[model samples]
Target: MKILVTGANGFLGRNLVEQLRNQGYDELLLCDRNTSESELEQFSQEAEFVYHLAGVNRPKKETEFIKGNTEFTEKLLHLLNENPNNPAVMFASSVQAELSNPYGESKKKAESFVQAYGEKNQTPVAIYRFPNLFGKWCKPNYNSVIATFCHNIARDIPVQVNNTETELTVAYIDDVVKELISLLEKSSFNETSVLYEITPTYKVKLGELVNLINTFKESRNDLSVPQLNQNLTKKMYSTYLSYLPEDDFSYDLTMHVDDRGSFTEFIRTPDRGQLSVNISKPGIVKGNHWHHTKNEKFLVVSGQGVIRFRKIGSDNIIEYFVSERKLEVVDIPVGYTHNIENLGESNMVTLMWVNEPFDSQHPDTYYTEV
Candidate 1:
């Protein structure tokens, strides 16, 4: 099906268009400010679906809002009228439309026009009043506070929060695209107004948002991953990584080196657990310790090793020979003293996962021979 997307170069429009292409919709007529009127007229005649996303949010003059938002919308609707297909159109309106400000007024006017035209001509239309939208490609300092904070914090730049307690409702760009795509499956309008709300919005306070961004910045040194169980934190963390400077993508971790080998912590989460990489040189033995409450899983990723475990205060010793050739994982039970010894001619690498993040102050580990 032929689809026409306005504001094709814009933040939201760019994301939606790329996803549509990824989904195998190639017959797309993308119209931006540079596209000529005649081209838009031609696209309007052939398009089976229309995504009306073009609008002016930060205009120098008030009249530009009407011209960009209302006038452009009217022009698109009129052009769609000339075609016999009566394509399903989706308008990217804003939550600001509920207010009386200049930008809001223009968006509200455009929304009203779309709704009335859909009712009068029996055309299917979907109208969305979006809150602050954030994700990759959104212009920092111009559109979304989340984008601005993510970009600035990733770059070690300063960010200011005017009110710490100010709450913001935010919508991710992916969620918005998914919601718009879902509308295409409907056969007819179920509601009288043809207005629809985007689902799964995230609410965050200004100060808390700043704190989360800061933690993301410090994650490298702490080797901590932000808790992903929370929906907002997961979305925000993804957005944060996208804004990281290209040359500054990778961070260095200090490896503890000794005569035996090297140990490095990769990731730590407050509630989830910690992941580490352990390297044992040939003829070297490491990790002669027992944990009272913390449990661990060790996977031999490279070379060969023998993991020996002994129950505390017991005479029995259990041994598990592991090698990268077989790719096996050994579970280290709590209250058992364990040691991993390199059994091959080369260094052995093991990936370790624990149940809790390690604390220096109160490490649950006790040094004991296996």
Candidate 2:
């Protein structure tokens, strides 16, 4: 399927693109400010679906918001109108778009533009109003609470709770992407407007979230005993002081490094995508064979390694010398013989993004050169 994605580099955009690509949609048109009008038009002609995510979010001024959110969206809708065969369009409208904030106001205006365009063209517009979204690629300094909490906890600092009683809903990035793709493939929108509230299955209290951070911190520090404090005000104050760091705490949490040079990590699903672990000792290789059905993307997470890959029926041998200084992602296509070895003093970790789920029985994998 030919698909176009805006804000392709942003957090949500990246996740969505990855999902689309994994589903075998390779003819993807990724657009952003860096993308030109010519490029957009070229893709618009070929794409069967357009996922509009590019816009100004959390602008400092109202004018900035109007230009980023409203004007930009109108421009894209105009582009869609010009296309003779209008492809299905999915607009990423924020829950804030329906609420009252400079960001929300701008998004609301953009939503109106989408609705008007859809009605005029007699096309179906799928609008997803997302609540607070948090996952990988999320930066700490942003308004996202998950990033803030992760940042504070990674540095052994306490998180601040603005509203103790307020409950917020969070949907994992995978779930959100799945829902979007489902809607796109289904294309069952009968009405002019198809709105869905995107959120996690459950809601979490703000104060309780803070406590969870503290619990995680304690577990990480290997603290066996729990500190008991009766005074609510004093407890909050103490937690805040104990966890706050000395330096710039607002830095991107994803890039935060420990003494060992490990950044904050995320859980990986083997079937869904790739996850890499470091091999401390040399000569350690995870897979020495080839998977017939598994297509994988491998990137050195840290240290150095020597990767050897050869496809069957080819006498040629290819080798890559990878290091921490050079961030190179090697795509291990299906039915290829490959092996990797750590070549540095430090451990070698590689993140692997796979196209399909891991299966042991019908692994579609075969050993070569034993």
RMSD of each: 1.5, 16.1
Which lDDT tens digits does candidate 1 get at residues 1-370? Answer: 8899999999999999999998888999999999999999999999988899999999999999999999999999999988888888899999999999999999999998898778777878888899988888998889788989999999889999889999999988899888776666656445566788877898899999999999999999898888888888988999999999999999898899998889999998888799999999998998899998999999999999899999999989999999999997799999899999998999999999999988899899999988
Q: Which candidate tops lDDT?
A: 1
Shift of residue 223 alpha carbon in model 2, Å: 9.8
lDDT of 2 by residue, 1-370 (tens): 6788989998789989888888888988999879998888787777778889887776676799889888888888888887776777888888787678888888888888888877887777788888777666666767688667767776756667768999987666666787778866555564634676664444678887677656645532331222334232233333333335557334332333443334332333433543434344555665668877777777886888888888877878788888878898888877678877777876777776666544566667788841
Model 2 alpha-carbon miss at residue 183, Å: 2.0
* Per-candidate TM-score against the hidden true structure: 0.96, 0.58
- Which candidate achieves the best TM-score against the true structure? 1
- The pairs that clash in candidate 2 are 157-243, 158-243, 274-352, 274-353, 276-350, 278-348, 278-349, 292-364
